[model samples]
Target: MARYDAIVVGAGFGGMGAAIQLDRLGLSDYVILEREADLGGTWHVNRYPGLAVDIASVTYSYSFEPNPYWSRLFAPGEELRRYAQHVAERYGLRRRMRFGTAVEQARWDADRRHWVVTTGSGELTARFLITATGFLSQPYTPPFPGIDGFTGRIVHTTAWPDDLDLTGQRVGVIGTGATAVQLVPELADVAAELTVFQRTPIWVVPKVDTPIPAAVQRLFAALPVTQRAARLANTAVLEAIMVAGVLEFTRAKVLNRGAGLLAKAHLRTSVRDPETRRALTPGYDFGCKRPTFSNRYFRVFNSAHVRLETGSIAEVTAGGIALADGSEVALDTLVLATGFDLWQANFPAITVRGRDGVDLGAWWRASRFQAYEGITVPRFPNFLSLNSPYSYSGLSYFTTVEAQMKHMGRLLGELARRGAATFEVTERANAEFLDRVTERLGTSVFYGGDCGSARSYYFDPHGEAALLRPTSTLNAHREAVRFPLDDYVYGGVPA
Candidate 1:
């Protein structure tokens, strides 16, 4: 069995950020274990048609490492994959990565003051463990009756196969989420007959996407400050929509309403038919569920070959799908763009046993999902979860990563100063943080708006919108750097 100072259970940007922090703290004895054979987590895994960053390319990346060569405002999935490779190479993180290694479980050894991580190959121990296995790691395929009996090609957006062409084939897509929004248009162009099964309509606004000129790229490369300004501008717009319009809905209702009206107007202008527009329109508030920016999604409905089916799905047959209205749609291929299983499968991603044999998944299910500062949890010593509850702050995931990096810096610096072997958040501190966030969420759209029909992943089965931190990005960053050091109890021998 090998041992190290730390073990990071992902190779995504989150895990990379954690590893960078560990390196900065002089704790270089760490390894990154990735389930896939490559480094770019979602970027490497998801290769469906029309896949691109919904957020602007200028703001989607790490603030510290900006890619000035992005071909378009919303860079394609391939660009993101390349960007991940660039970051990994630039940070010298490739040497520490172990691909094709999936961690099955991790248990805290109280007597030894380390984490014993179990994988298929063997077990490894580490003084600290950071689980950055992204929130969208697990893909969900709803168990529609007779789905297994389907003889046609069945594909999930997450596990899209290479060289699988849908050209001239009758295809059925079973989602209308962000991935489906991007993919449906692409499929409609190629499929001889296309049927979209939308359970809940999604709110989509017009995307301001355009290719970046070579001159503009050169300017950004020469003066990095220009890109920084652009990123700041985009971040501000997203902050207003997410923080003010959603979290501060009680006070900034106008902003939220204005956004909804904009989307409605876009939908009205794009779709020719009034009934089709109505069918595509979302009934819930704008911020109830995650929205997407798209110029082609609504317009694709105008195509004669495309058909929208709002009827409830009864089951999947050997031939095709059966609807609740006794209608059937035969297809050569069935695509499941049902998105990720967040609340159930991905909250913990892997089994984690902490002090006193406390299972993290069971605890979150039995109680409320929470993490102290979205990093540390009580009874989980020397463990940090990058994708924990209230961790996601803004539209750009990089914001969350940078903020958590700051948090790790502060917390780990204190640990080094104290020469402690382990650090765990106090139960009182964790409870206080959870209570504060829950109280603040009372004003958010997920809690106050008509989210019952939205079917948003933000709300768990317990009806708690514990996904995003109910605070501005600036505030989250500030708190990350200035959080009370006493909240955590550092113990054991000197490092």
Candidate 2:
């Protein structure tokens, strides 16, 4: 078995960031295990039409290796993939990475203090393991009646066939998430007729996208300090605005209503048809599910070729989709915008052990996977989950990621310097931290029973909110970044 000091899982932004930091800190003995054949994670897999980042392109890059070559306000998937590959090569991370080798299960070698890592090829051992396998890695397709028997091409946005063409065919697109938002408009132009099956409506915003000029890109690259300062300023301003929108501490119900009203006005202004505009508009509050934007999505309905069905897809027939209203739609192609099992899809790929033969999944399952401060969990010693559950902020994912990772790095560094074998968060510390998180989330509009759409993944099974962090990114950042060295229980994995 091959031995290493650490093992990093997944090759997405989080994992790449982790590996880059580890190597820069002189921990290159670590290996990054990628399930796919290449470095890009979601970016590589998702190649559907008109796909682009909803966030601004300028600040979406890594703070360490800032890229100034983004061609648009919203960078497309391919450019991001190239950027990932470029960053990996630049950092010399590809040398230590093990592509196409997935860690099936990792067994903790308790007697010797190391992880016996099992992959598709063989087994290896490592002193430490990092679960950078991000919040959304796995694509989940819901099982529908006669789905396999459908006499049509079936495709998932996360796993699109690059060669597959939809020209002049009748298409059935299901689920109105980000993928459907972008693809529906593109498909409208090509398909003879398109039917969209939406289980619930999501808030749609206009994506104000524009291509960045080559001159601007060159100028930003030329002045590193200017780029950094602009990024910091942009980050701060957006975060402040978002925090105010979420918190009920000072804002009135009228104010919250006003924000929602403003979003509605934008929708009406872009989408000319009243019926078409209302169909695309969400009945729920903003940020119930992550709001998506595409200038084309709303206007796509104006095309006589497209039809949006807000009714639930009762089942899939051989011909097409069976709506809840006993209506049948015909199609030659089917696209599922049903998103990945975001929070818990990677549970099967992981094998984590804690004290007394305690299984991490089982412990987490018992608690329904809620973590303290959305960072630490009881029993999982020295295990750090990046962008973990409930810690995810829709407003600024990158900022939260960098701040929390920097904090985890500090604790890991202290443990390494002290020769500590293992470290686990104490139960009391976690309980107190979680109380604050849950309390803050309680008052947010996401949990306010007013907005009516079917219970979303943003809410837990028992009707508790799950998707967002507490109001303030600054508060969450400070809580995560300013960890006291004395609070962590330290012992080496080999102790």
Top-TM-score candidate index? 1
The TM-scores of all predictions, comma-separated, are: 0.99, 0.93
> Residue by residue across 1-495, what tens digits does model 2's lDDT show?
888877888887877877776765666788888888888777777889887777776677788788888888789888989988998899888888888987787766666777777898998877667777766667778889889889888998888888988999999888888788888888888899998887677676556788888888898899988778867776775665455555452344565566567768777877778877777767776655666667777777777888878787778888898888898898899998888775453453476665566766656555765666666667666566664657675365676566666766777788788877776777777776667777876666765535457446666544566556765666766766576766677874443
Q: Write the per-residue lDDT of candidate 1 for residues 413-485, one digit (tens) a residue.
A: 9998988888999999999999999999999988777787899998887889989999999999999999999
Highest lDDT, which number?
Answer: 1
Segments of candidate 2 deviating more than 4 angstroms = 247-255, 343-349, 449-454, 492-495
> Model 1: how far is 82 from its true place, Å?
0.4
Scored against the true structure, residue 315 in model 1 reaches a CA lDDT of: 89
As a whole number from 0 to 100, the lDDT of residue 23 in candidate 1 is 95
- The 0-to-1 C-alpha lDDT of every candidate, in the order given, reads 0.94, 0.73
